[model samples]
Target: MTRAARPGAAATRPGFVWALPAAVFFLMFALTPLLLVVVLSFTSWDGIGEPRFNGLDNWTALLHDPVMIQSVWTTLLLTALGVVTQTPVSILLGVWAAGHQRNRAVLSAVYFVPLLLSATAVSVVWRAVLDPNFGVPAQLTWLFGDGNLLGSKGGAIGVLTFVGVWQFTPLHALIYQGGARAIPQVLYQAAAVDGAGRVRQFLHVTLPQLRNTIITSVILMVVGGLTTFDTVLILTQGGPGTDTTVTAYYMYQKAFKGFDFGVGSAIALVLVVVATLISLAVVRLSGYDRMRGTAEGL
Candidate 1:
């Protein structure tokens, strides 16, 4: 009996040993880089040179930087617009798609095409569309009158917002569609028997069931909006006079263009902190933790 028990314990030891490899991999690949960035955020370093400890100077400079302030404001604005625009559109599209099972695959594919495209590709496409002279806007201006959409601050930001929505709507739509499809047909049948109209059914049944999915999608879009860099960089280049520069772009400029790694790292740290806080706030407001079980059903 003792010898048989010893063999079983030896077999179990391999599983414990396998867990060690995963822990070691995570420490080496993930934790180490994060810790290095945190350390670098408090020190000054030119790319080619060794980092030197600078204490709070980097943080202090960040507080005083006008560009940094502007970047933060722009990031907030984009995030707000994304949440407001993307959530409902995705929900509506998702509801519609879920109802049309025969067409779901084709519609999902069409909607997801933009998402499959690279950031560089999106930028190039939009750049051509927004070109001041020979682009789609120019043709539209010829038909309308003096409507230089990308030439003005509001218009530029609006275009950026629209592009962001277009790119991300498919992702949100898929999320919502999955949620909507998971809802039992019995609920819809009961709602119909009670003479509930489309709007009321959506409001009372669909929306409540989708609360968790909406929260998750909104959080993802908010973080993406706040950290948007590639699209803005390619489309407006923070142009029309720094009107479109989000915090990510500012971080890039500071670190790469201005050779200020410490300040750049500080900005990156701020972005991480802000995104985390906002996500937590959304989860709390939406009662996502409480609804975790229901959401799993969807």
Candidate 2:
């Protein structure tokens, strides 16, 4: 009997034609709206009439607006805090969860439950829990003061950051878990032979091996942090006098609440530019765009 023939690479490889539909969809939905928003930024619109040409007006207003400036700083502050808090936690949890132990597998399933909930649901649940009159804070007045987490600037910001860490860490943890598993076991054995203990092995071998994964996770965190809206809306409504107002929420307030679509579009464009530039810079600096590092061998 003749041996079965293997499929050729030419046959297995997908061509660009197969991706045309997705490309078209992205162009229609993503690029088209973005282009419209860019144009809208240079025009005055209130969602009632046609956009009127008003070059530099929106930009000038946004640049001089104190609230806009505060929102940018607030955005950066939240994003930075998220990165600092979530990255280490995700890495540690991911490494631990990557183990083949059955107990760990069970715990990992439980740990990732938060990621399954919608942001809206999570916010609603937490909002109730933090309610000053009816929630846990009410019962524990001695500890939580008035339990009005959404009332003050510091309290609202704290709740937002905490919710972010709780809800998003699982996702980054899963990313790191996959990266940890992809690391070659031989490297660990070699470290062991060289008298490296668990801590040293993890630091010298595991961390270096997970550089690309770390970068990927960090980029995702930065983007998510920048675009945070639903949580803020449901939790604080940008209240406490704009203390918790992020750029994304500010854009919504301008476009929808205040009926200033021009400034809102400008804010939206700025957000897109900021996120793109930061992500691109990170990719360039980390050499990740070239697909370098631990992925080479496997």
Candidate 3:
């Protein structure tokens, strides 16, 4: 007769069997490409040719590259503007919609419509809206007479930021709405009993409760803004003199247009590092681990 398996054997078996496949898949698909990119960053390669090892030459060149530097700055600016502009609006709309349960479905659907459209579609629509000569701006100019909104730096950045905010606020609003729903109504009732007004209740109860969701939404928006390419490419193509070329777009131009694969890889690697660091920093700052701990405690 066979001996009975030990108590911990079953638990170990599943993990051991699963671990090998998961590790193999990760190494083959994920880690291997990352390693190749890291290796390529140190080599000079045109798209069709073999790469020649050049040590840190690509990175060194990137450091002195004006366009790359501007792209990085623009990306950071866009991310900052996106978060600042979108977060409060999303939270306010979410809280309002959640509070007004009667109109929650209609309002949520209205806000989420933009997110359903592809970036290309949104960019095309907005391009016409912002066009100075024959679009909505022109119509407005006819009423108000001759102002080129898309031509000016401030106006251009404002339009980009506005588009980013409009497209993403709905996503965050939905996330926040879910978070708001999860909040126990008894807390609101208690706050009301203590003579707290709507704004006070939101500050004291809703904001703190929805902190984790807000953190997550902000992280998503920031990353999207940082790496944004399609909408900017369609709308501005880093136009008005490189005002809107984000790091991702810059890398695309470097790899494709300039045909500097090695330098492009280095820039892409820097973007990955930046995104990873920002995500980690946000999670830590927002006390994401604390939420995990609470869930574990429960």
Candidate 4:
């Protein structure tokens, strides 16, 4: 009797026609621009004229520009803050909500309200709410003295961080909530039999079970921080100074305001490289590609 073909081979068989539309879309929109940017980064183009080959001039300028350096630092700081503050808080919120069945729906809705609004809307609303003359700042004058958060370097940074955390935390919490729900109830019972208190059970069973979810959250946080633009643009517009001007903002200024497409492309390319490297490092450190069980091993 003839052996039937394996499912794996059948599944892996080329389906070029089925994939054609997606392949075409990727090539036209994604791959084309990426290739264009790499080519443009080596040319001196002012967005209007023909691009003239400029070698390493743009790269050298990017390396030495003080404002560029500051923006890069700010971007890194923002990403770091998101990773530090958002991911764990999201998990904690998820755990709290999961344990409290009655309030879960209400709590989830409240947390997710910010996400329902467009980024532009959130920025506008927050701008008004944080206005020094008439908003929360006015009420908190005793704490902040001048209460002009968007008008100061450190305050602007803090405001951006707050906005980032507020907007994304709910989404991350949802991710964690799903992961938490998937965990076998038996694990908690086993831990309880071993005298594991709530905290101990969380540290041992819940967290370990959510290892993949946590790593995924971290990646989203980092990437979100890197690409954060509309909030800063609408709220602060890169600041009273350059303090809130992230690498993305700086790249925009170079490309649009400065009309230097070459340098702007270089900055974009640099950010792409940095983000990719950082993501890979996070995955490697978390051992995300290794064995699937046990957070300790990861």
Candidate 5:
């Protein structure tokens, strides 16, 4: 005999049949290319003749390369910075925008314009704005010193990190905004009845409700930060020395510029492995993978 379904519970969770198409597509596209890259990583090829198997040469080279190590650290540092800077701001803006206030509609429209611009466009605009000749630093020399924001290591990294935060924060904000809107209003009303103030409501009611959303947003941010490419290519070009030579750009240089496809493939494979491991760790530690119910209604 069938048991009666409980009210407010998910009536019909998506089954494996619903996911078959995407699974097939992923296997055909993503997994196929990944396997090809794995094979290429084990071979020496310059994009000319047939690739010759080189075994552990490509792997061992990157293991001992000082620049490679530094690039890994830089990638991790930028990713960490992005999470730290973007999370709170995104949450605040998102929660605010989730309100019924009229100003929110107007402000959100203007605030979301940055996401319309491509990474290349963002980089170019920022580069012009920071130009030593006539950019903000030039006009405000006393404030900006020499106006060479991309000339030095710290300045270059700062610009890159800021640009990343600026361009990507809106997207994360949208995610949080949606998550906030999805929360049951009864919870907030009950909290209000309990004499919970605005700050208390947010801290206790909103944040806990958005836990899964936060996990999702953070996973996206980590992946985006790890694989940031176009901005680095267009803005800094991994220049002013290798100060900004992140792993992605370094792979580009090795593969395209240096004409060492083998090494580049090896680096790319390693990046994929590292990103996967870190994402799994986040899911595991957050207990997102072990839970069964949704984040709301608590």
Candidate 6:
């Protein structure tokens, strides 16, 4: 015969009961605000009195706004640069660190230093360092006798891309390093027995094992690129004629500076949709969904 249930045992049993507090917190903080944003996006509010219902007006404006379109293109460009530059560098560094323990500490310290600095601090330091007259960049560009990196369109994008890559690649490297180390040593041994060299082993064994991690890293970096504003705002103020103005900063300007919260909310929601689509594309392109059941079957 089963023992009689203790008082409140059913309520205290192993289940989502323990998650109630966190679920409550998420509902109160996250879900509520998100719902409010969605509601507000459909209304016309100027951070003042009444929020009049104005359906799709802000979204319609976004479709034709040249500045919004430019900001979107800029955001995509930065994200593409981050993916292209950071992913390979991170994988290479992670592989190097995982394979060789001798300099791992030094490498990790060097790579992670930028991440420790606040974005504003980093931007301020870089701004000083890139000063056209007296900065290191000036000295370097003295070879060609043309300096002014922060002034030109291509140069502004390049600096923003460099900063994005510099700050983010270390996190991706840590992800890859963890993934590399988690791989079974027996697999490497078997690959070696089959005449696989280091490069071939990496290509065949390491990369396949780290595929999910890489996909996760790509999604994170892409999202980061889409939402990046603090560094660009602090450094360039989206200056040199909006060359570095990403959608995030544009949203901020519309919301705070221009006092157009409805438009900003629409832009924020659009960014959310765009980010979701891009993340799904990354997952599909990396074949993450296809790899799901194979591991369980194995």
**Which candidate achieves the best TM-score against the true structure?**
4
Candidate 2, poorest ten consecutive residues by summed lDDT? 1-10
Using all chains and alpha carbons, the TM-scores for the candidates as numbered come to: 0.89, 0.91, 0.90, 0.92, 0.91, 0.89
Global Cα RMSD, each model: 4.7, 4.1, 4.4, 3.3, 3.9, 4.2
Worst 10-residue stretch by lDDT in candidate 1? 289-298
Encode model 5's per-residue lDDT on 1-298: one tens digit a residue. 4979778467576779999999999999999999999999999999999999999999999999998999999899889988999999999999999987899978987999999999899999998998998888888989889888889988988999899889998999999999999988988999999999999999999998899999999999999999988988988998778888999999999999998999999999979998999999999999989764554236
Off by more than 4 A, model 2: 1-17, 139-143, 295-298
Model 1, span 222-262: residue lDDT tens: 88888899988888888778888789998898899989898
Model 5 misplaced stretches (Cα beyond 4 Å): 1-24, 292-298
In model 3, where is the ten-residue run with the lowest total lDDT? 289-298
Scored against the true structure, residue 250 in model 4 reaches a CA lDDT of 85
Clashes of each: 0, 0, 0, 0, 0, 0
Ranking by TM-score: 4, 2, 5, 3, 1, 6
lDDT of 3 by residue, 1-298 (tens): 5989899887667656668988999999999988888998999999787899999999989899888898899899989999999999999888777766657778677878998998899989998877777777677866525656556667778888999888888888888888888888888898999999998999998898887888889889878987888877887888778777789988898889989889889988999999999988998887786665212222
Q: Write the per-residue lDDT of candidate 2 for residues 1-298, one digit (tens) a residue.
A: 4766677956887999999999999999999999999999999999899899999999999999999999988998999999999999999999999999999999999999999999999999999888889998999989889787788888898899999999999999999999999999999998999999999999999999999999999999999999999999999988899998999999999999999999999999999999999899989998989887675665
lDDT of 2 at 26: 100
Question: Which structure is stronger by lDDT: 1 or 5?
Answer: 5
**1-298: candidate 4 lDDT, tens digit per residue:** 4889887987888888989999999999999999999999999999787999999999999889999999989999989988898988899988776754667778787877876888889889889999888999798888877887888888998988898888888889888888888788888998999999999999999998998989988988888888888888898889878889999988898899999999999999999998998899889999987747643432
